[model samples]
Target: MTIDSFTKLYERAVDLQRLMSPFITGHLVVEFLLRKLIQIYDVSLTQHADDLKHARLISLNHNISTITDAQKDALVGINKIRNKFAHRITHEPTLADLKTLFIKCKDAFSDFTDGIEQGLSEIDGAASVDQLEEWEIHELFIQIAYDLHHVYHNRGGDIEEF
Candidate 1:
């Protein structure tokens, strides 16, 4: 990846560090990575229509089989969560909403989620989804974004396979 991409991601991530809503901010970070990945396949989209919506952005990544099914579900769930927050005023994510989407990631991708849980536990005792704080939800978003980024960066190997 170019240093400019690295700088942009780092800047957005730093913004996420001070976020009040991790789901929203994490969505933004993940969206940026998605946009970059799309650019890899259709660089013209960057010049023509850069601000594609969440679902559209994700649809572009649909055929990237390198991304696991659980990863795809997490991206869709993240988009759904962002939409719910966007349309409502003063909305706090209920535990059930968090459970279906955020908790599902923990089950589907235990390896990364375990690392996330450990870090969150150290800071805020957020070891499990049972006691999920808003910040912990944000960490889940960060984890999903990093996994997409891993796929994006390593796609050269996948290209030939496709």
Candidate 2:
């Protein structure tokens, strides 16, 4: 894929993260990551949630080493949440729901939170920078998605119609 297309995908994920429900945003971000992985590894994949699940297994089998264990766990959590929203008529993930998921996958998010905090401190904000609150799960997820995108691009992944 062209850099433009990659960037557009990342931006769309970020936009969804900012404005959509947590489940929807998480699903979109995970989907974006899966698609990027397919391109990165040149794997034949259909765009399905099951394919996304299998991508992780295939990556491990191929030794592609795409995501950390914590990231894999986080993706699983995201998928569960997305599934709940999709299958249940009254299911809507709240901020608290997302926060719990983040806590459950805290290890995966440590580097991202640290980087965001450092970046925030470097900027001149109205108030002194402190820890990111629980309500910032959306921002946290956005940064994580951005970092994942950079990882793929930095590792020389590109899209070319074949």
Best by lDDT: 1
> Local error of candidate 2 at 91, Å?
1.2
lDDT of 2 by residue, 5-89 (tens): 7666576555432323644665677566656665666545434324545445434423556677667776677767767655653
Give residue 76's lDDT in candidate 2 (0 to 100): 71
Ten residues in sequence with the least summed lDDT for candidate 1: 121-130
In model 1, which runs have C-alpha deviations exceeding 4 angstroms? 1-20, 64-66, 107-132, 156-162
Candidate 2 lDDT score relative to the true structure: 0.53
Instruction: Give candidates' CA RMSD values in order.
Output: 10.0, 11.2
Candidate 2: pairs in clash? 1-158, 1-159
What would the per-residue lDDT of candidate 1 be over residues 96-145, giving only the tens digit for each residue? Answer: 56556645575545446564555334334434333444556566776776
Pick the TM-score winner: 1
